[model samples]
Target: MTNAADRIAVSTWSLHRMMGTTYPHNLDTLEVGPVTEAYGPVNESLLDIPSAIANHGINRLEIVSFHIPTRDKVYLGELKSALAAVDVTLQTLLIDAGDISDPLTSDRDTRWIASWIETANELGAERARVIAGKQKPTRDALDLSVKKLTELADGNAGSAVRLTTENWFDLLAEPGHVNFILDKLDGRVGLNGDFGNWGGPTKYADLRAIFGRAETCHAKASFVDGTLDEADYAACIEAAEAAGYKGPYTLIFDANAPHEWDGIAAEKAFIEARIG
Candidate 1:
């Protein structure tokens, strides 16, 4: 059996600083066009990240869609090969853009999101996580999201790359909305519970509600004055355990100023101490 320390995973989001660059190529006119933004002349190549992460003793990774500079098959194949070389598993390919809840543009966004499933397959990822919606919570909006999400799941029927949605953005800001929509989907789509997405005194209780169905997790810990909020982090972990969640805890570390790899290592050490 895999030890608890072995269950730790990393999300490329934690290394955004080291990456120092991002790609904005996707559908959805919610903001801007696919114009390339300048951040890095990249410090490290995406293909090299697998080994970098492996060096830290993490064998699983969730990649943000934008972090992947291209959908080119050759490049995708090279990334897959890099992961194979290090024996790192691509836990999930996170499709961070698009709002399938918008009635006007959802049709276009749905097609755009579906296209990435092929890309995930190319990278040999275990799942492709999509944003359920960006619209405000309402019966019509939730139902529309469910329809689109179900369509994506059905459209990819029998795909080895499973489909997942997160408790994020306006549509799922609350547990009621999350459970409602996932229930509506009726197992068509799975959950990727994110610790930092929802906040408040009720965060722990809310986590318990949705994480029970979570196939993966985004274990984002809060920091203040450059210190980990161990209370919050511990409670979040306890909540997930209470919900009976058994999945990789993908660490997410975004700081005001970064020593991203250091922040990640700190979080990893905390988790390993508790569950190792």
Candidate 2:
């Protein structure tokens, strides 16, 4: 059985902008402050996420590297050190590799992606979150993405990092498309399920279809009138659990408000109640 503590993790992306008194790039320079004051000044570029975890009572963290500039090994090392100093471990690294529909794939983009995978492994990330981006529905483009992802996964085969793509746009967003990609790639690639990004009505069913292939998940809660739609939220979690997912429920609260944190806490409570 999965312990409740092991099954819940908060995304630093949710509070990327707030954590310390000053936006220090290294852990030694960070000035720990009250949670309320740290809510809006923490720069994602900096590595103060450990301080966020410490003050927020959250143990697991999903760090988004897209917010950080790419291919800077020195900066990546500093960030990793900061997290280590705070005793906060990374669960996954979320990245926007590039546009899947780009006709001629850019070598520069591919190099950056390879470097991103290296950095995630160095930071001790168990999985890397990638998105297929906007799709133009071309056979060549889809084939190129699959090839690139497979190569990426192979490159990191010996490491703890696994490459997982999220369903977005019209290509990988459909259940059929997800199955196709996963089956074609086999174990070389996996899914990063985002509950809010499904573009259809059967959100729960769609999630269930891809759950078997999922390596990580994002609990993206879109609020209505200061409260999440309880039914939708519950259904998503239920489908994930029913599919035998026993991983941390990573939360991504993108709403803009001081009470957004409150909403996140409430959502966490709701998920915990159901899981427990």
Q: Please tell me which predicted candidate would have the highest lDDT against the true structure.
A: 1
Residue-level error in angstroms, candidate 1, position 15? 0.6
User: In candidate 2, what residue range of length 10 has the lowest lDDT sum?
Assistant: 24-33
Residues 103-162 of candidate 2 have per-residue lDDT tens digits of 454334555566667878877887887666456656776777777777677778788887
Q: What TM-score, over all chains together, does every model reach?
A: 0.94, 0.83
Cα lDDT tens digits, model 1, 170-249, are 99999899999889988888999999998998999999998899999999998887888999999999999899888888
Q: Which ten residues in a row have the lowest lDDT in candidate 1?
A: 28-37
Q: What do the candidate models score in CA lDDT, each in turn?
A: 0.87, 0.70
Tell me which residue pairs clash in candidate 1. Answer: none
How far is 226's C-alpha from truth in model 1 (Å)?
1.7
Q: Pick the candidate with the highest TM-score.
A: 1
